[model samples]
Target: MKRLFRILIIGLSTLALAACSQIATDANSLFVSELTEKEDAILSIASDKSFVFDFHIDSEYKEASVWIEKYEAGKLVDDRLAHLTTEVEQSGSIIVTLSENTNENNNSFNIGVGTDENLTSINVSDTDLIGLESMASVWGSTSEKVAIDNGEAVLANISYSDDENGMHSLTTDFFEDAAGHMNELEKYDVAYLLKVEFVK
Candidate 1:
Protein backbone atom coordinates (compact mmCIF):
# COMPACT_ATOMS: atom_id res chain seq x y z
CA MET A 1 0.00 0.00 0.00
CA LYS A 2 2.83 2.43 0.84
CA ARG A 3 4.50 1.87 -2.55
CA LEU A 4 1.23 2.36 -4.37
CA PHE A 5 0.58 5.64 -2.59
CA ARG A 6 4.04 6.94 -3.51
CA ILE A 7 3.52 6.08 -7.14
CA LEU A 8 0.14 7.78 -7.22
CA ILE A 9 1.58 10.98 -5.73
CA ILE A 10 4.40 11.04 -8.27
CA GLY A 11 2.00 10.60 -11.16
CA LEU A 12 -0.24 13.38 -9.95
CA SER A 13 2.72 15.74 -9.56
CA THR A 14 3.98 15.03 -13.05
CA LEU A 15 0.55 15.56 -14.59
CA ALA A 16 0.15 18.87 -12.75
CA LEU A 17 3.54 20.10 -13.94
CA ALA A 18 2.79 19.11 -17.51
CA ALA A 19 -0.57 20.92 -17.42
CA CYS A 20 1.06 24.05 -16.11
CA SER A 21 3.74 23.92 -18.79
CA GLN A 22 1.17 23.51 -21.52
CA ILE A 23 -0.85 26.47 -20.24
CA ALA A 24 2.25 28.67 -20.17
CA THR A 25 3.18 27.64 -23.69
CA ASP A 26 -0.29 28.18 -25.11
CA ALA A 27 -1.22 31.37 -23.17
CA ASN A 28 0.33 33.71 -25.71
CA SER A 29 -1.52 32.38 -28.73
CA LEU A 30 -4.80 31.85 -26.93
CA PHE A 31 -5.04 35.42 -25.64
CA VAL A 32 -2.95 37.43 -28.08
CA SER A 33 -3.16 35.86 -31.53
CA GLU A 34 -5.62 36.34 -34.42
CA LEU A 35 -6.19 40.04 -33.60
CA THR A 36 -7.13 42.18 -36.60
CA GLU A 37 -8.09 45.79 -37.11
CA LYS A 38 -11.85 46.16 -37.32
CA GLU A 39 -12.46 49.89 -37.22
CA ASP A 40 -10.83 53.41 -37.44
CA ALA A 41 -12.35 56.75 -38.42
CA ILE A 42 -11.41 60.40 -37.94
CA LEU A 43 -13.53 63.30 -39.21
CA SER A 44 -12.67 66.99 -38.97
CA ILE A 45 -15.45 69.43 -39.76
CA ALA A 46 -15.29 73.23 -39.96
CA SER A 47 -18.24 75.58 -40.32
CA ASP A 48 -19.74 78.90 -39.34
CA LYS A 49 -23.18 79.80 -37.93
CA SER A 50 -22.50 77.17 -35.25
CA PHE A 51 -24.42 74.38 -36.90
CA VAL A 52 -24.15 70.86 -35.47
CA PHE A 53 -22.99 67.95 -37.63
CA ASP A 54 -23.48 64.39 -36.43
CA PHE A 55 -21.89 61.33 -38.06
CA HIS A 56 -21.92 57.65 -37.16
CA ILE A 57 -20.19 54.61 -38.74
CA ASP A 58 -21.31 51.16 -37.62
CA SER A 59 -18.36 49.34 -39.20
CA GLU A 60 -15.06 49.99 -40.98
CA TYR A 61 -15.17 53.07 -43.18
CA LYS A 62 -13.39 53.53 -46.48
CA GLU A 63 -12.29 56.77 -48.13
CA ALA A 64 -15.20 59.21 -47.92
CA SER A 65 -16.06 62.90 -48.25
CA VAL A 66 -17.95 65.18 -45.88
CA TRP A 67 -20.18 68.07 -46.94
CA ILE A 68 -22.04 70.60 -44.81
CA GLU A 69 -24.47 73.08 -46.36
CA LYS A 70 -26.15 76.18 -45.05
CA TYR A 71 -29.58 77.36 -46.08
CA GLU A 72 -31.56 80.62 -45.79
CA ALA A 73 -35.03 81.75 -46.97
CA GLY A 74 -35.87 78.19 -48.15
CA LYS A 75 -32.88 78.23 -50.47
CA LEU A 76 -29.23 77.32 -50.50
CA VAL A 77 -27.42 80.30 -48.96
CA ASP A 78 -23.84 79.04 -48.75
CA ASP A 79 -21.96 75.81 -49.43
CA ARG A 80 -18.42 76.80 -48.48
CA LEU A 81 -17.52 73.93 -46.15
CA ALA A 82 -14.18 73.24 -47.75
CA HIS A 83 -10.52 72.42 -47.16
CA LEU A 84 -11.59 69.03 -45.82
CA THR A 85 -9.58 65.83 -46.16
CA THR A 86 -10.02 62.38 -44.60
CA GLU A 87 -7.12 60.41 -43.13
CA VAL A 88 -7.91 56.97 -41.74
CA GLU A 89 -5.81 54.15 -40.40
CA GLN A 90 -4.95 51.82 -43.21
CA SER A 91 -6.40 48.78 -41.43
CA GLY A 92 -8.58 49.76 -38.47
CA SER A 93 -12.03 51.35 -38.12
CA ILE A 94 -13.40 53.85 -35.57
CA ILE A 95 -17.05 54.82 -35.50
CA VAL A 96 -17.95 58.40 -34.61
CA THR A 97 -21.36 59.92 -33.93
CA LEU A 98 -22.90 63.10 -32.56
CA SER A 99 -25.99 63.82 -30.43
CA GLU A 100 -27.61 66.69 -28.60
CA ASN A 101 -27.66 67.18 -24.83
CA THR A 102 -29.76 69.84 -23.16
CA ASN A 103 -28.98 71.17 -19.71
CA GLU A 104 -30.41 74.19 -17.90
CA ASN A 105 -31.46 76.11 -21.01
CA ASN A 106 -28.21 75.20 -22.75
CA ASN A 107 -27.38 72.95 -25.67
CA SER A 108 -24.32 70.83 -26.43
CA PHE A 109 -23.28 68.09 -28.81
CA ASN A 110 -22.13 64.71 -27.52
CA ILE A 111 -19.73 62.48 -29.42
CA GLY A 112 -20.01 58.70 -29.15
CA VAL A 113 -17.66 55.88 -30.13
CA GLY A 114 -17.99 52.11 -29.78
CA THR A 115 -15.69 49.97 -27.62
CA ASP A 116 -14.69 46.36 -26.96
CA GLU A 117 -13.85 44.09 -24.02
CA ASN A 118 -10.10 43.84 -24.65
CA LEU A 119 -9.68 47.32 -23.17
CA THR A 120 -7.44 47.30 -20.07
CA SER A 121 -9.66 49.22 -17.70
CA ILE A 122 -8.29 50.01 -14.26
CA ASN A 123 -10.72 50.52 -11.44
CA VAL A 124 -9.34 53.44 -9.42
CA SER A 125 -11.70 53.21 -6.48
CA ASP A 126 -13.04 50.11 -4.75
CA THR A 127 -16.38 51.10 -3.33
CA ASP A 128 -20.10 51.35 -3.98
CA LEU A 129 -20.02 55.04 -3.07
CA ILE A 130 -19.22 57.48 -5.89
CA GLY A 131 -16.71 60.30 -5.82
CA LEU A 132 -16.07 63.56 -7.62
CA GLU A 133 -17.15 64.18 -11.23
CA SER A 134 -14.92 65.38 -14.06
CA MET A 135 -13.95 64.59 -17.63
CA ALA A 136 -10.65 62.89 -18.49
CA SER A 137 -8.92 60.77 -21.10
CA VAL A 138 -6.32 58.02 -20.61
CA TRP A 139 -3.94 57.27 -23.43
CA GLY A 140 -0.93 55.07 -24.21
CA SER A 141 1.23 54.43 -27.26
CA THR A 142 -0.55 51.36 -28.62
CA SER A 143 -3.77 52.18 -26.84
CA GLU A 144 -6.53 53.91 -28.80
CA LYS A 145 -7.95 57.27 -27.78
CA VAL A 146 -10.67 56.92 -25.11
CA ALA A 147 -12.95 59.42 -23.36
CA ILE A 148 -14.57 59.08 -19.96
CA ASP A 149 -16.95 60.90 -17.68
CA ASN A 150 -16.50 61.89 -14.00
CA GLY A 151 -15.24 59.09 -11.76
CA GLU A 152 -11.60 58.34 -11.03
CA ALA A 153 -9.09 61.19 -10.90
CA VAL A 154 -6.34 61.18 -13.51
CA LEU A 155 -2.96 61.76 -11.98
CA ALA A 156 -0.45 64.18 -13.45
CA ASN A 157 1.91 61.30 -14.17
CA ILE A 158 -0.81 59.55 -16.25
CA SER A 159 -1.19 56.79 -13.71
CA TYR A 160 -4.54 56.85 -11.85
CA SER A 161 -6.01 58.03 -8.55
CA ASP A 162 -8.54 55.47 -7.26
CA ASP A 163 -10.30 52.50 -8.85
CA GLU A 164 -13.59 54.18 -9.70
CA ASN A 165 -16.00 54.72 -12.55
CA GLY A 166 -15.00 57.00 -15.46
CA MET A 167 -11.56 55.43 -15.30
CA HIS A 168 -10.31 54.58 -18.80
CA SER A 169 -8.42 51.55 -20.10
CA LEU A 170 -5.91 50.50 -22.76
CA THR A 171 -6.10 47.90 -25.54
CA THR A 172 -3.81 46.89 -28.41
CA ASP A 173 -1.12 44.49 -29.56
CA PHE A 174 1.31 46.28 -27.26
CA PHE A 175 0.45 44.12 -24.28
CA GLU A 176 1.28 40.68 -25.74
CA ASP A 177 5.03 40.97 -25.87
CA ALA A 178 5.25 43.65 -23.17
CA ALA A 179 4.00 41.02 -20.78
CA GLY A 180 7.07 38.91 -21.72
CA HIS A 181 5.22 36.36 -23.81
CA MET A 182 6.75 34.38 -26.68
CA ASN A 183 4.79 35.84 -29.60
CA GLU A 184 5.59 39.33 -30.82
CA LEU A 185 2.77 41.82 -30.56
CA GLU A 186 1.59 43.74 -33.59
CA LYS A 187 -1.04 46.43 -34.11
CA TYR A 188 -4.47 44.84 -34.29
CA ASP A 189 -6.79 45.66 -37.16
CA VAL A 190 -9.60 46.43 -34.73
CA ALA A 191 -9.43 49.88 -33.16
CA TYR A 192 -10.98 50.80 -29.85
CA LEU A 193 -14.28 52.71 -29.74
CA LEU A 194 -15.51 55.64 -27.64
CA LYS A 195 -19.09 56.51 -26.60
CA VAL A 196 -20.63 58.79 -24.01
CA GLU A 197 -23.59 61.07 -23.10
CA PHE A 198 -23.23 64.26 -21.09
CA VAL A 199 -25.14 67.50 -20.62
CA LYS A 200 -23.34 70.21 -22.47
Candidate 2:
Protein backbone atom coordinates (compact mmCIF):
# COMPACT_ATOMS: atom_id res chain seq x y z
CA MET A 1 0.00 0.00 0.00
CA LYS A 2 2.86 2.43 0.84
CA ARG A 3 4.50 1.74 -2.51
CA LEU A 4 1.24 2.33 -4.35
CA PHE A 5 0.73 5.66 -2.55
CA ARG A 6 4.25 6.77 -3.44
CA ILE A 7 3.60 5.95 -7.10
CA LEU A 8 0.40 8.01 -7.04
CA ILE A 9 2.22 11.05 -5.58
CA ILE A 10 4.94 10.80 -8.15
CA GLY A 11 2.38 10.60 -10.91
CA LEU A 12 0.60 13.68 -9.62
CA SER A 13 3.82 15.70 -9.47
CA THR A 14 4.65 14.75 -13.04
CA LEU A 15 1.22 15.76 -14.20
CA ALA A 16 1.56 19.14 -12.49
CA LEU A 17 4.89 19.82 -14.12
CA ALA A 18 3.60 18.76 -17.50
CA ALA A 19 0.63 21.06 -17.11
CA CYS A 20 2.91 24.00 -16.31
CA SER A 21 5.02 23.32 -19.35
CA GLN A 22 2.01 23.16 -21.60
CA ILE A 23 0.71 26.40 -20.21
CA ALA A 24 3.99 28.16 -20.89
CA THR A 25 4.17 26.84 -24.43
CA ASP A 26 0.64 27.89 -25.18
CA ALA A 27 1.22 31.41 -23.82
CA ASN A 28 4.37 31.85 -25.87
CA SER A 29 2.63 30.74 -29.01
CA LEU A 30 -0.18 33.17 -28.49
CA PHE A 31 2.22 36.03 -27.83
CA VAL A 32 4.34 35.33 -30.88
CA SER A 33 1.32 34.96 -33.13
CA GLU A 34 -0.08 38.29 -32.02
CA LEU A 35 3.24 40.05 -32.47
CA THR A 36 3.70 38.59 -35.94
CA GLU A 37 0.27 39.77 -37.01
CA LYS A 38 0.86 43.33 -35.88
CA GLU A 39 4.35 43.50 -37.29
CA ASP A 40 3.22 42.13 -40.62
CA ALA A 41 0.50 44.72 -40.88
CA ILE A 42 2.86 47.53 -39.91
CA LEU A 43 5.43 46.46 -42.47
CA SER A 44 2.88 45.90 -45.17
CA ILE A 45 1.67 49.49 -44.98
CA ALA A 46 4.92 51.23 -44.08
CA SER A 47 5.67 54.04 -46.57
CA ASP A 48 9.24 54.96 -45.70
CA LYS A 49 11.05 51.63 -45.62
CA SER A 50 14.58 52.95 -45.94
CA PHE A 51 17.36 51.94 -43.59
CA VAL A 52 17.64 54.73 -41.05
CA PHE A 53 20.31 55.55 -38.50
CA ASP A 54 18.90 57.98 -35.97
CA PHE A 55 21.51 58.03 -33.21
CA HIS A 56 23.12 60.67 -31.01
CA ILE A 57 25.63 60.73 -28.21
CA ASP A 58 26.37 63.59 -25.86
CA SER A 59 29.39 65.66 -26.84
CA GLU A 60 30.34 65.74 -23.19
CA TYR A 61 30.39 61.94 -23.05
CA LYS A 62 33.43 60.74 -21.18
CA GLU A 63 34.16 57.01 -21.38
CA ALA A 64 32.98 55.08 -18.31
CA SER A 65 31.84 58.30 -16.69
CA VAL A 66 28.08 57.75 -17.00
CA TRP A 67 27.45 54.82 -14.66
CA ILE A 68 24.15 53.00 -14.40
CA GLU A 69 21.99 54.96 -12.06
CA LYS A 70 20.15 53.25 -9.19
CA TYR A 71 16.42 52.62 -9.59
CA GLU A 72 15.21 55.15 -7.07
CA ALA A 73 17.46 58.07 -7.86
CA GLY A 74 15.44 60.56 -9.91
CA LYS A 75 17.12 62.49 -12.73
CA LEU A 76 20.46 63.46 -11.26
CA VAL A 77 21.91 65.51 -14.11
CA ASP A 78 20.79 67.13 -17.34
CA ASP A 79 22.52 68.50 -20.43
CA ARG A 80 21.25 70.42 -23.40
CA LEU A 81 22.98 70.20 -26.80
CA ALA A 82 24.35 66.76 -25.95
CA HIS A 83 23.70 65.33 -29.42
CA LEU A 84 26.98 65.02 -31.31
CA THR A 85 27.18 64.52 -35.05
CA THR A 86 27.71 60.99 -36.45
CA GLU A 87 27.88 59.02 -39.74
CA VAL A 88 25.90 55.73 -40.05
CA GLU A 89 25.71 53.17 -42.86
CA GLN A 90 22.70 51.25 -44.14
CA SER A 91 22.40 48.18 -41.87
CA GLY A 92 25.03 47.05 -39.39
CA SER A 93 25.92 47.08 -35.70
CA ILE A 94 27.32 50.53 -35.04
CA ILE A 95 27.61 51.80 -31.50
CA VAL A 96 25.11 54.66 -30.91
CA THR A 97 25.26 56.67 -27.75
CA LEU A 98 23.24 58.99 -25.48
CA SER A 99 24.33 60.84 -22.37
CA GLU A 100 22.85 62.51 -19.29
CA ASN A 101 25.07 65.47 -20.07
CA THR A 102 23.08 65.95 -23.26
CA ASN A 103 19.77 67.09 -24.70
CA GLU A 104 17.96 63.77 -24.58
CA ASN A 105 18.25 60.77 -22.27
CA ASN A 106 20.57 58.18 -23.81
CA ASN A 107 19.17 55.21 -21.96
CA SER A 108 15.78 55.65 -23.59
CA PHE A 109 16.55 55.06 -27.27
CA ASN A 110 14.71 54.77 -30.61
CA ILE A 111 15.08 52.64 -33.79
CA GLY A 112 12.94 52.63 -36.93
CA VAL A 113 12.44 53.51 -40.63
CA GLY A 114 14.38 56.25 -42.37
CA THR A 115 13.10 57.54 -45.67
CA ASP A 116 11.47 53.87 -49.12
CA GLU A 117 11.76 50.17 -49.26
CA ASN A 118 15.53 50.37 -48.96
CA LEU A 119 15.99 49.29 -45.34
CA THR A 120 15.44 45.56 -44.93
CA SER A 121 16.27 44.95 -41.27
CA ILE A 122 15.60 46.21 -37.77
CA ASN A 123 18.64 47.55 -35.96
CA VAL A 124 19.13 44.96 -33.23
CA SER A 125 22.65 45.12 -31.88
CA ASP A 126 24.70 45.88 -28.78
CA THR A 127 24.13 49.10 -26.84
CA ASP A 128 26.47 50.95 -24.49
CA LEU A 129 23.91 52.58 -22.27
CA ILE A 130 22.49 52.09 -18.74
CA GLY A 131 19.61 49.69 -18.04
CA LEU A 132 15.97 48.78 -18.75
CA GLU A 133 12.75 47.99 -16.79
CA SER A 134 9.32 47.02 -18.13
CA MET A 135 6.42 49.43 -18.19
CA ALA A 136 3.38 49.67 -20.56
CA SER A 137 5.49 48.20 -23.33
CA VAL A 138 9.09 49.20 -24.02
CA TRP A 139 9.22 52.90 -24.80
CA GLY A 140 5.39 53.06 -25.16
CA SER A 141 5.16 50.62 -28.09
CA THR A 142 2.89 47.57 -27.92
CA SER A 143 5.10 44.93 -29.58
CA GLU A 144 7.88 44.70 -26.98
CA LYS A 145 9.51 41.55 -28.36
CA VAL A 146 12.16 39.20 -26.94
CA ALA A 147 15.59 40.69 -26.21
CA ILE A 148 18.98 39.09 -25.36
CA ASP A 149 20.90 41.87 -23.68
CA ASN A 150 24.16 41.58 -21.77
CA GLY A 151 22.60 41.99 -18.29
CA GLU A 152 19.86 44.62 -18.37
CA ALA A 153 16.10 44.53 -17.85
CA VAL A 154 14.10 42.42 -20.28
CA LEU A 155 10.47 42.97 -21.06
CA ALA A 156 8.50 40.22 -22.67
CA ASN A 157 9.82 39.01 -19.35
CA ILE A 158 7.67 36.03 -20.18
CA SER A 159 10.66 34.69 -22.13
CA TYR A 160 13.91 35.49 -20.22
CA SER A 161 15.49 36.69 -17.01
CA ASP A 162 18.35 39.04 -16.08
CA ASP A 163 21.86 37.62 -16.32
CA GLU A 164 23.13 36.50 -12.88
CA ASN A 165 26.65 37.87 -13.26
CA GLY A 166 26.61 41.65 -12.75
CA MET A 167 28.94 42.80 -15.46
CA HIS A 168 28.71 45.87 -17.68
CA SER A 169 27.22 44.50 -20.85
CA LEU A 170 26.35 46.42 -24.03
CA THR A 171 24.34 44.32 -26.43
CA THR A 172 20.70 43.71 -27.43
CA ASP A 173 19.32 41.05 -29.76
CA PHE A 174 15.91 42.05 -31.06
CA PHE A 175 15.12 41.51 -34.74
CA GLU A 176 18.65 40.60 -35.74
CA ASP A 177 19.26 41.49 -39.42
CA ALA A 178 16.15 39.96 -41.02
CA ALA A 179 16.48 36.73 -39.05
CA GLY A 180 12.93 36.72 -37.61
CA HIS A 181 9.59 36.71 -39.42
CA MET A 182 8.96 40.28 -38.39
CA ASN A 183 11.43 42.50 -40.22
CA GLU A 184 11.63 46.29 -40.38
CA LEU A 185 8.76 48.82 -40.01
CA GLU A 186 8.63 48.31 -36.24
CA LYS A 187 9.50 51.52 -34.44
CA TYR A 188 11.24 50.67 -31.17
CA ASP A 189 11.27 53.05 -28.24
CA VAL A 190 13.00 51.24 -25.41
CA ALA A 191 12.45 52.39 -21.79
CA TYR A 192 14.13 49.80 -19.59
CA LEU A 193 16.63 51.39 -17.26
CA LEU A 194 17.17 51.87 -13.53
CA LYS A 195 19.18 55.05 -13.12
CA VAL A 196 21.96 55.30 -10.51
CA GLU A 197 24.83 57.65 -9.85
CA PHE A 198 28.35 56.94 -11.15
CA VAL A 199 29.43 53.56 -9.78
CA LYS A 200 32.89 52.26 -8.99
**Which numbered prediction scores highest in TM-score against the true structure?**
1
Q: Write the per-residue lDDT of candidate 1 for residues 69-165, one digit (tens) a residue.
A: 2222123333421212243211111222221121221111221111121111111111211221222323233232222122111111111223345
- The CA-based lDDT of model 1 is what? 0.22
Error of 1 at 144 (Å): 25
Model 2 poorest ten-residue lDDT run: 47-56
List lDDT for all candidates, in order. Answer: 0.22, 0.22
lDDT of 2 by residue, 1-200 (tens): 22332332233323333333444332111112221343334323332121111111222321111112211122213221112222222111111122121222133221221111121112222233334342112111113322322122222110111335322221234322222322221222222222111111
